[model samples]
Target: MKSPSVVMLRRNLKHIARNPTSVFNAVLMPVIVMLMFVYMIGDAFNVGVNYVDYATPGLLLLAVCYGLGSVAVSVNSDMTKGVINRFKVMDVPRSAVLTGHVVASVLTNLIAVAAIIGVAFALGFNPSASFMQWLEVIGIVVLLGFATGWLTVALGLFAKTPETAGMAAIPLIMLPFFSSAIVPADKMGPGLREFAKYQPFTPIIETLRGLLAGAPAASDVLQALAWLVGIVVVGYLWAFASFTKRA
Candidate 1:
C-alpha cells in the first residue's frame, strides 16, 4: 500500500506544479536579495572574502524564511476550502495530511534555494567548502524547512482565513533583513546590533557562511541547531494540538 503521507505529498505537489505562482512567490524575495546585494552595492560590505561567498549563506537562510510562507498559505487554503475537513472524515492517518504538506514545502524550498544559488553561481559565487560542508548546508536547510515550516503550518491552522495566514507570516520575511542576511550584524546600531547578533537567524546565517567560507562555526552551528530544536518542539505541539481540535 502507498503510504498515506506519500499520497498526500503527491497531491500537494500537483497543486504546486499547477499553480506556478506559489513557487514564484515563495522564492522571489531570496532571488531579489541575491541579485540586488551582490550586483548593486557588494563593494560596500568590505568583507575580506568574495561578496558572493559572503552573501550566499545569508541568501539561503532568507530563502528558507521566505519560502515557508507558502506552507502557511497552502495549509490555510485546504482548511478554508473544507479539504482538510474532508480528510478528517476519511480513514487516513490524520498526521499524514500535515506531513504531506511539510514534505512538499521542504521540497519546494529546496527548489527555491537551488534556483537562487544557481543565479548566484552565474554571477560568480564561488564556493570554497568541501563535500562535508556542502552536506552541512543541505542538512541545515532541511532542518530549517521542517522547523520553521511547522510553525507556518500552525499559523495557518490558527488563522481564520488564508489571507490572515499569509499576513501572519510577514514577520518571517522581515526577520532576515533585521538579522545578518545582507550585512554584518556589527554594522547596526548598538541595541539593534545586539539584537541582531543573538537572534535565531543570525546564527543560522553565520553557520552557513562559516561552513561555506571555511571559517570556524562550531558555536554558531550548535546555536542554530538549538534554535531549530526549540522551534520544532513548540511548533509541533501547537500544530498537532490545533489540528486535533479542528479535526
Candidate 2:
C-alpha cells in the first residue's frame, strides 16, 4: 500500500495544478527582483563582481523565500475553513498534509530557480566550476528552500490568519539582505559585519559563492550545513507540536 504521505503528495499536485498563479509568483516576483537589482541598480554599488553573478544565488534563494507567501496563505485558508481539522478527523497521516505542501513549494521554487538561472545565463553569469561544483551549489539552494519552507510552515500554523502569516514571513524574507548576499560582510561597518558574520544566511551564502567561484571552502560548507540542519530540526519540532495540539 502507498504511504499516507504519498497520497497527500498526489492531492497536493492536483491542488497546485488547479491554482497555477501560486507557481507563477514563485517565478515572477523573484525574476523582477533580479532584474531590478542586477540591471537597474547593480552598477551604482560597484560591488566588484558581475552584478548578475552576485545576485543569481541570492535571487534564487529569494524565490524560495517568496514562495513561502503562498504556503502561509494556503495553510491559513485551510485552518480558517476547518479543512485542516477535517483532515485530522480522517485516517490520513498527520504529517503528510504539511509535508505535501512543503514538497510542492520546494518543487515550484526549483522551477522558479530555473528561470532565474536562465536570466542569469543570458546576462553572462557563467559558473566556471566543474559539474560536481554546480551540483553542490544546486543541492545547497534546494536544501535552503526546504529549510525556509519549514520555517514558513511554523509561521502559518501559529498565526491567527493568513494575512498575519504573510506579515510574519516578511522578516524571514528580508533576513537574507543583512547577509553577504550583495556585498562582502567585511566591507560593512564593524558592528554590521559582526552581525552578518554570525547570521544564519551568511555561511550559507558564503558556501554558495565559494562553490560558484570554484573555490571549495570546508569551513563555509560545514557552517552552512550546520545552519540548515539546525533550522530543519527545530522548525519541524515546533510545527509538529503546533499541528498535533491545535489542528
1-247 per-residue lDDT for model 1 (tens digits): 8989999999989988887677777677679878888989998997777888888888897788776666788898888898988887787787899889888888988988998789889989888789988888899999998988888888989888888888988897788888987889888999999989999899999988888877747899899999999998888889888888876
lDDT per model vs. reference: 0.85, 0.81
Give candidate 2's whole-model lDDT. Answer: 0.81
Separate clash counts for every candidate: 0, 0
Q: Considering summed lDDT, which 10 consecutive residues are worst modelled in model 1?
A: 20-29
Determine which window of 10 residues in candidate 2 has minimal summed lDDT: 53-62
lDDT of 2 by residue, 148-207 (tens): 888888888888888998887888888878888777788889899998899999888888
Extract clashing residue pairs from model 2.
none
